[model samples]
Target chain A: MPTIDILLPGFGLDTDQGYPAFCGVFLVRGPDAAGQPRNILVDAAHVGRRPFLWTALADHGLSADDIDTVVLTHAHWDHVQNIDLFPGATLVVHPDERRYAHTPHANDWATPAWTGLLLEQLPVREVGDGEEIIPGVEVLGLPGHSPGSIGLVVHTEAGRATITGDALHFAYVATTGRNPLVFWDADQAARSIGRILDVSDVIYPGHDRPFRLTADGGIDYLAPFALTVTGAGPDTPGLRFADSSARPSWVMPGIQEQRALYEKNADDSARRISRVPRVVRPAAAPRAAGPGSG
Target chain B: MPTIDILLPGFGLDTDQGYPAFCGVFLVRGPDAAGQPRNILVDAAHVGRRPFLWTALADHGLSADDIDTVVLTHAHWDHVQNIDLFPGATLVVHPDERRYAHTPHANDWATPAWTGLLLEQLPVREVGDGEEIIPGVEVLGLPGHSPGSIGLVVHTEAGRATITGDALHFAYVATTGRNPLVFWDADQAARSIGRILDVSDVIYPGHDRPFRLTADGGIDYLAPFALTVTGAGPDTPGLRFADSSARPSWVMPGIQEQRALYEKNADDSARRISRVPRVVRPAAAPRAAGPGSG
Candidate 1:
């Protein structure tokens, strides 16, 4: 049987002030078709996490070339910006995702129109639901957050380990039975979460730590959250980590949320008072993309 | 005389692991043509910063309706995602930016092609470089970061204050004399930075704090950095901030950087080692578009 190692844990933290736009990067290692050991990276994180991703790989005595496959759960800028880092690997994505990137709607602010440019140039293989990337690691259809969002069902030694992208962004979405950041159908998103719950023993979310369903249907985290800051600054003194016990709430507006909010705010609306033109401060707070997050 | 207040500051923090997709949102309050009090928001930050933007405005006892005009520094999704929030405000963008957003290049990943869809629907008044949105608030041409990138030159009571979106993203770009994230022209970017230095007593960047030039040609930050985080979590133990002594470093890969790195890595190189299906670890880190400012 193959095994799974969570290279990093995703934190569930979003704010109204800004969006800490970080997702999970997973690495799955198992035997190839020929029974040879193979390494498959689930997602290549955006540019911000490259240094940390490299370090995470290094800790496991690995490098980008050691892997032979890169599976992208979706094609959001934050989820799949590092494909160039793995030039030798064959890229795996859903065909629907590839098609959607070509004509993404303006409301889909997360998908850059130019993304198709990169996707077109890369050597890619389209994988759909139930397709096996390798033995014991099968692709699962988990759309919602994106049109072609997919998940991975890895037959790990302990049990079934599931990795779902934004379809199951955080633990709350799973427990609440509602995916908050839906870009597609909300009902579809709910069904997708059902798919995740049906197959998952331990679930890894797109922007959160690994967790499992408790005996009484509660949540139990698999690991402690940890992060390291790279560039150091002053205006901020005594930098530390966030509190762990609290619920991880990602304050992002999905398509449905946006539509609802827009409809509400635009109702014969009149907005008020305000600016010295002071932009995002701390040179990073607004662009916080803090240590690591959603 | 009407004055300005920097409700927030932009950060100069970007990492390879993630792209803290954020920019500056400036509120310019002054008298209208009839000498009545008016507020013009320079840039409407993306969805990520809606909470902070709202708080920042409320600090002055203002709301979205108070904004009469919106000056888009450029059309990157990060700079203009929240335009829907200000329905009454007439948007001010360069005609060239408006045109370019119609068909952005694939390399310009920061620009979502659907951007044109949003730009087209807004109540827009195309402003060119050297055009005045209001008294003493002028738009300056500072292309290079994007095809139609522009800057703002505001005549404040203190002196001449300038807001350069990504043309002068950080202090290093100004001092180092080179923009690390150029999508248009390298030489043009250099010239744009020169334009910023020529007519400013103080500078507000897209993703860094406000700073001024000292007598000895050194940079001095005008204020201490402050940030408030919402929806705290655990895995992180200490809740502190960054060091002000260290220089701000945004580790994003520009088109040039990507090409250079791609070339260097893809030259008959075989890279190695790695994985489990573990994606980006944080709910926010992968999507770390953290707190106020860029």
Candidate 2:
């Protein structure tokens, strides 16, 4: 059985004025079938959280090399920018997600052009629905936020903990069928969320803390939200820590455009590979397909 | 002369938790020597700000193609991710910045592994210190946050508006003489900031709004901070907008390690190319050396 730790808790917050720099990072530790120690990192985390990841790992008295496998739920920038840091770890991504990343629309800012190529440079493995990452860890296909979104299910002593990347970004997703951001199919996204709820006893979201479903079907939060704002300037935010006492109504930017593009790309295959060079074909150099191959 | 508009006013705020998702996006609209209207976008905000950029551009009655050139202050992910959207515009960046981006440390999270490769796919024009990007805008070297960090100096009607990328991240750099983050050389970063102050009347920072130097050698902010937090979950921050009120003391992370790596790499040049694939050599496909080469 694997025990999980939230390396950095995700905050369900985004600024409409500019960027929303919040994403969750998890570390799962357990013994492999041979009884050897293993550390599996869930989500590489976007660049902003790099320092926090480092500190968290050090707090565990471990280094990046200590991480045996990195399971990326999705390739959104917020969730997968620090892949390079874990040089010794194998990256486990969905096969379809890898191909999907190679065909992101130019407007899909979340999937930058270099996404596919960067992943190609490193060691990787394709793990999809019903796949076991190690032992007692199962892969769940949670597509909707992006074409190839997936989640991981880890069997723990407490119960079944589902590490959802963006499939269930916030606990609110359980209450409201709508996710804050969606990149692929909303219908599929909804179904994925439902699937997550069906199997998950304690849910680990992409942008929020862990929450368990109550017997009456109510959601109970396991932690409080904390986002410490640094880089203070003269006219920037006056508050160092984002005040959690109050918040605004969420706005879904380009959700319609995102869905329309998904529809458009489904109709036209060529547009799918439009930006593959960065997200396109990647380098001419042959890349090792699986992270374990290295 | 180019008239500058803060298409999206940058908020000087970043959460210590995960990612700092704030970078300024500026639109410079004016006429070329031929007298035709030219729109220049300074700094392509990270994925988080893509919507803000789109909405701002749309508000300006323009689209991505409407801009003729994109002047990147630096190649950090936060400052330059949406370059693909402007398919037709030429990218203006410092030549050394491009090469420097080709070789960044693996731990340098600000400069992701894919920074160089993505820019290689775009139309680029290498501009350097004292070089004119247009008739009035000049490229200035500001290599601190990353080796290739550069700022742009534009001849605005109000006076010279220097677009300082991570060179001078926050306005407080003017008074405190220390940037919150420094990647390449702290000395060079400091010098670059001094140069920005020496040559500019108004300053446009990478993560903050535009400001002017006060008559008594102080900073005069032109705008208030506004970072609207959305996706309000049941347990997330109660505030919709990041409160710009009392802040905590900023802690500097990995400064010593950063400088140590700089010295170590300075001793062993091989370490310079550690993570250049994403920051590495990029693809086997020969990239056009300059954005103008496209």
Candidate 3:
């Protein structure tokens, strides 16, 4: 059995202001080659909040060095910034993705300077479609949002859970079959989405809550409430959740936002807090018997 | 003074049935560091037609080994396929482009297997925006089609001629301000086009026939007639020239189409010519007083 912990169930709340709602890191704790428990991290989150990654790991009674492998979905800047935190871990990326990260199109989001500097210090391994990194965890080539974006499918006790980094930005996209706003090839993205739907019953999107396929073939959001955008404008939409008036459980104070606020108003004693990254305890604990349950 | 030869004026005629009408290679004959005559090649056409490149070079009394340097506009497969032909030449590419060539997105037109193999053997030098690769030949960061797509601005005796590889696919795109159907970022492409229009007086596009700018800021096609796609459908259009009903000079028997034709009708005697790359002579010799002429 394996445990998938949402280290930071990233932004989807109206209360989350003045913070970059980019990405979250997930810790996949499973048995290694020798059946000993090993922790693998997916995505590193934006570079500005590296401390939050350390805090999130600490909450699970783990340390940065505990991560044996870092399976990157893609090399977009927001997802690869905190890779330095796991210096000893082996870095695994899709072959095309590794190439894309090194030589990305000008329009695509990539941090060549940062990625280049990190690769110099770490050993990187390339994985392709259907290749297994750990037992029951196979890599899926999901190209559309990127040339080399990949998804990890893990066979858990609950069911098969697929961790799709940006491949499916919002859980709603899976249900509607509409892709995210940004992508490399729209036709290919649409095809990849179809492939994802056929393979997995449970999905953890790059952003938003985890979702499960109901017996009647309907998508069920794990969170009590899910955010919905009202207007067609590209600007940030006013946040409102489905099925509830109260905020969702995953909302937490952003580390960089808090630091900036403290610097801006030094005299505000109430805002002064520890400078370390702290685990954000959700208001309502995630359902124990949900999709990601081991 | 330097000469700019349209080694292969890319497809526009309807006769090019089965060929990929994607790119053309331009030979910029200019003086190098010590005022010695140097032949610099901008972009190498698609890999499928390697013999055509050899024949084109031979037509100009030059050979593959005669090339002094190769300045890549970007790393798209169509533009970099024949890089191996210039083994001894110095390979200069935009730093971002060099990265892009290595790690291109899945949707982008990149032959990673071929590019990777070639890179392993050739040493590539990085060039940045506004940097001069040769005397009077400066590199401009024209990002849109690809992250590291660059344009070469050559100060010739005729005028300032900019070789925009795929950045300005059609002269109409520059005139109408509409981007090509294929692009990485639409906004960035528009900005790059504007920069090109401002800096260069004469332009040589990647796919279409070369066009010069008039005193009234309108584009003037160098050819007697040009091809225009009518109707909204994406399929191939009927060919017609702007000022004349007759076909313009540079149409040739497409190699891929000929191969396909030969395969379909094995007994066709006309199609079964010697399997060697032949020089495609223009119906009318190019003007000696144009932008590329020395």
Which candidate has the top score in lDDT?
2
Instruction: Provide chain B TM-scores across all predictions.
Output: 0.77, 0.79, 0.71
Q: Total clashing residue pairs per candidate?
A: 110, 37, 8
Model 3 per-residue lDDT tens digits across residues A1-294: 776788766433211111133464788988867898888999876533444565678889988778888888877755765565666688888766654443333223233212333332346788999998888888999876766789999888868888888777776677666465443555667777888888887888886678887787677977543222211112213222233222222211232242244244443221111111111111243568978778
Error of 3 at A161 (Å): 43
Q: Which pairs, if any, clash in model 3?
A: A99-B103, A100-B103, A103-B99, A103-B100, A106-B147, A147-B106, B4-B292, B226-B241
User: What TM-score does structure 3 among the candidates reach?
Assistant: 0.40
Candidate 2, residue B45: the lDDT equals 77
- For candidate 1, write residues B1-294 as lDDT tens digits: 446677556755443334455566777878866788888887777655655777898998898777878888898867876675566678888866776665454445566434554554346798888987778888899987776788888899878899888888767666777777766667787899999999999898887777897887788987665444333423346323344334443333444553344345332222110101111111232455768847
Model 2, C-alpha of B247: deviation from truth (Å): 9.5
**B123-242 per-residue lDDT for model 2 (tens digits):** 678777788766887788787666677888899888999988878877877776666676666777778888999999999887777899898887798877655444443244532234
Q: How would you encode candidate 2's per-residue C-alpha lDDT over A125-146 as one tens digit per residue?
A: 8887999876888899998878
lDDT of 3 by residue, B91-160 (tens): 8887665544433332232323123323323356888889987788899888866666889998877688
DockQ of 3: 0.01
Could you estimate the TM-score for every candidate?
0.61, 0.82, 0.40
Off by over 4 Å in 2: A230-294, B231-294
